[model samples]
Target: MPFESIQGRGATRNAVPARFNLPERLVEGDWLDEVEALDGVSQRRTTITVERPKSILTRNSSPDIGFDRSINPYRGCEHGCIYCFARPTHAYHDLSPGVDFESRLFVKPDAAKLLHAALSRPGYDVAPIALGTNTDPYQPIEGRFRITRSVIELLTETGHPFTITTKSNRVLRDLDLIAPAAHRGLAAVAVSVTSLDPAISRTLEPRAPAGLKRIEAIRRLNDAGVPTLLAVAPIIPQITDHELERIVAAGAEAGARVAFYLPVRLPHEVAPLFRAWLDDHYPDRAAKVMATIQSMRGGKDNDPNFFTRMQGHGPWADLLRTRFAAATRKADLGTGRLKLRRDLFRAPEGRQMRLL
Candidate 1:
């Protein structure tokens, strides 16, 4: 059967239902048509659709995470990191967490406006707002949409404190605004650098900026007096894990004040996609790599228990933590901790306005 689009009168929080159970392949119908039948079919270009969320600040009570609120200006990141945990979120929009997650995207045109409204409420609490937590705020689409920049502008104007995490150097474009905010302890940034090997980074995070460029971004941000941190995230075991020390050292040399690392996490659809990527790229060592991952993930493809999920469990996980701690000390990075100034936050006046 041919695929069809389903439309609803109004968007709902759970509006888009996923069709994950559909057959993986389809065959052409036997209609007795000639070769010319396919000759005139022109593919339609997919268009971007904007979805205005009623509210933007996603609140979390999970003790394992540091931030209580975050703002993602866009959905379905274009960065196309195969192992991205946020990919499965697209399923809620009736979109595939694979290709559609990257190609078919949703932009929140009213993010800044919604944020202002929320913050203006009498009971609104001012805490460091996290950006780029779910999907990258500075992904390639940001260049055109400019939603992330708009949010930053609002935060700067309101004298609100915020933290950003990104894998792109494109963030530098807004340094003019970020630098001043940093001067007031209202802004800080973390750059995610998965691997120093350009080739590995190319395949692992196909659309993200190169590893060196990210490091350079850290150097430049630090030079501008921003509290920069190097996030050696998702340090895949037996793969990029070997480069942990090298990454920390490089970030230290780049003037990063702090360094953090997260062991690879494979949740929901991300598990299968990551496995496929592993099979395609490192067929020879796929088994060994997965074995190492399982060792860290409590002998399973994933470990979902609170704190354990972020740090992992078992001997292998312990070893990773020990190694990371040692590397950070050797590199003269943070003595295992870097703190952001929370006392500097001030509530911005006025209701949040929407960005058209």
Candidate 2:
């Protein structure tokens, strides 16, 4: 693990993905706070770079994913969730999935323009375009850039249906617009509440909203007439899995219409990073936790097959699914997939020209 010792960030260690054929480096001691006192570790500050991509809509026909298209307003999330599957994407740019992924971020300022152009293209078809499917769209930089707001505004104006997933209450800032769109069957939201335990949340997802805050956000969204769901995502097997039922119960009590859960997944660089995190935070149970994860993932760190990837396999996976089902039923929260209307989608009219 070159550049592997940088500690105290979301990832305990990291290196450039081997696929790039780049040589990696190692630190003897305290390179950017590696192998130093916990308090001495440098704070990882976030830097957002603006990008003007040619397109904003990403299309995929994967059978496992509900939506056909999605828009990631940013690349490299600052939320710093250790288990994030999207972390490997940063490796494509010669960046470490460790500190770089959390400290360095990229945002699309012209996302609205590209989205409008794509929607207006000839032969464009309508489907609910998903947000926050990769990097969280509501990550803290959003407060300054407001890129997500522009996206929602464009969608609202065109009557296009969309689904947003987030762990931030920042989405509440757009409640006035979201409530209207949701009323017209054009918008929905899912708030990911990974753990109700403040300690676990602080370590696992340092920058995401606290669990109760997310639940409160769901309740508020529902009260405002937005269809809200609870996402108990990336459930750690030996760690947070036991909280599945409680998570569902809490969210349902808070007015979430439905609940969804996915067992922890360790894809590519995420596996090693996660193992290091386990060793750092839970040294005693690290081996057992990895063993249990491999068991659920069919003797591998992860199962990449489309159908099996989300829920996983084997006894642990089955038990989790059963527990989730039982909890959702007991709490009377719908487990059914949310289906947003695509018929309401229409291209926005051309931007009005300003007099010179």
Candidate 3:
């Protein structure tokens, strides 16, 4: 059977002459047949593209999130974590939130420029700006683009306070800037460590730095006198949940001053991608994992309710929370109250002119 290609956005036709008509949304996974029949398909290398958003900071009103304004220098994280909650955001650009979300990415080349402009606005209130909120600002592409670094430099120059959340140790590269900012009460960082198991880290967050390296990053940041927090996010029930205590213990050992965790969220396309990942990696335990998730999600794949979304409700969720609390206490993480200094915020010079 000769392969037939389908055209733009319509019902999928038979790619293999007459194998059988599958749904337009589904395509057969026969690489040999595809290579033999299509020259163009075989010649493409997945390349990264730059997207110039007119603005950099995104405003949000969700009660669950702490920040009102956040900046993401890149879209479609290269870390390729199958459980990424930000994956569905790609669909808004008419791109698939699956493979395309991990491969075909968009970097905001003008991110630093736009951020300077936004921050310089006369009415721009100086609160702690959040970075790596939607997509990781320090993801792999950052090594080349260096947009995240530029933004950090700009923030530091203006004496602005900011917060960062990232899973990659690549953030350490900007320590020269971050350390000084921390000295001035202008910065805080949260390093997200999902699991201590290297193998699980590999499959769960395929392209992110190894867990050990992230621990090292935590150590390095804290050693430099930077305020560091350990984020044990997306505690997948029955799967990675068992490692929560170990992860928290390790973070405390590495000198993390604070710790936090959130339940796994599956919004839109992410649900199917995560399910597929489970089927591929942990087929035997997939059903139990999802059942546990459902128990927390009010008997569904997810619960989008604001506060409920971050921390699910149920026995499993409750137990996970209790365990995390106990482990952090045992490890002496966050021994006493610590808070980011908002008093250090000062409007960057020339904000009014820049906004104009």
Candidate 4:
């Protein structure tokens, strides 16, 4: 059966992995087809589930990425980016890594409390807590739940340093909190812009803010004295690769101090989902895109090694790096890293500490 692209959703199918032994879902009878024929495909409304986890801070020892500790106020992003590497995480809950990973969302309402508890520990180490590492902290639900705002408030009060990476302009809504933190050298923001063309962006990131809005957000954040990094992440081969230089120049025009790019990574479930997406939307060039990606990835769908994973291997990868460096230089956007200050961190006064 051919996978049909869902309107306003990224994944072409909602498929559960075989490792979980979950039964495959199929519409039971012809009645569904009759209803669809009459009324067209029904829209998939997003469902939010509140999760109260014991810990809010996730610590990682991976040497590939910069930060060691991070916080994700939500799981399963609704932005519906088909290339999201985090999609496979949905499998742990016996859920499909495809559409279910985007529609069946989870928010941590108690994230602030958990963060407070973690920070108040006697021997808590102070390091930058990365937000939006696994799932975007500023996803649409944050506007309703305010869980991410609460976490940021707690961090701000304690003078702890953190970084935010998001594709939404909604981060501007919390500028009151973030501006002060940036002044204290305790915060920075990275805005990810996948494509400048609205049409390409619509299908590539169905629910994310348009590229122009995100670019404007970079300008606003910079005007507020917040150091902004423009991230042109997951630069898909034969898809949005042509816009690399234009994106960098736009970021520079918007006052982003630094810029970076990553090649599209198709690890685990993301591979199949992205392939399906290409088949549906770009059938004419899907094979070419995948072949170019494989050539860059050393003839594999993805490279799992630490260093090579971030920087793809082979000729195409080298060319991408060269182009990125040249583009950044041309745009006057520094390739230097943004360092968030951790010296100003103050542990929240715990109950036992109050007695002292």
- Best candidate, lDDT: 4
Cα lDDT of model 1 by residue, 1-356, tens digit: 23212121011011122346543321122222322334343221224789978999999999888889999998887677877889778777666666567656899999999887887778767888999999999998899989999899988887788999999999999999999999988899999999889778767786788899999999999999999999999899878999999999999999999888999999877777777778877889999988998988878898888999999888988988899999999988884434555665445665454453
Best by TM-score: 4
What lDDT does candidate 1 reach at residue 325? 95
Predicted candidate 3 versus true structure: per-residue lDDT over 116-171, tens digit per residue: 78876777777778999988988888999999999998888878888999999999
* Distance from true location, Cα of 126 in model 1, Å: 1.1
Better of 3 and 4 by TM-score: 4
Ranking by TM-score: 4, 2, 1, 3
- What TM-score quantifies how close candidate 4 is to the native fold? 0.94
Better of 1 and 2 by TM-score: 2
Cα error of candidate 3 at position 354, Å:
13
Question: lDDT per model, in order?
Answer: 0.80, 0.85, 0.79, 0.88
The C-alpha TM-scores of every prediction are 0.86, 0.92, 0.86, 0.94
Query: Where is model 2 poorest over a 10-residue stretch in terms of lDDT?
Result: 26-35
Poorly placed runs, candidate 4 (over 4 Å): 1-5, 26-41, 352-356
Name the regions of candidate 2 deviating beyond 4 angstroms.
1-8, 25-42, 351-356
lDDT of 2 by residue, 186-256 (tens): 89999998899999987798878889988899989999999998999989977898788888999999899
Tens-digit lDDT string for candidate 4 (222-306): 9999999999998999999999999999999999999989999999889988999999999999999999999988898998889
Candidate 3 is scored at a TM of 0.86
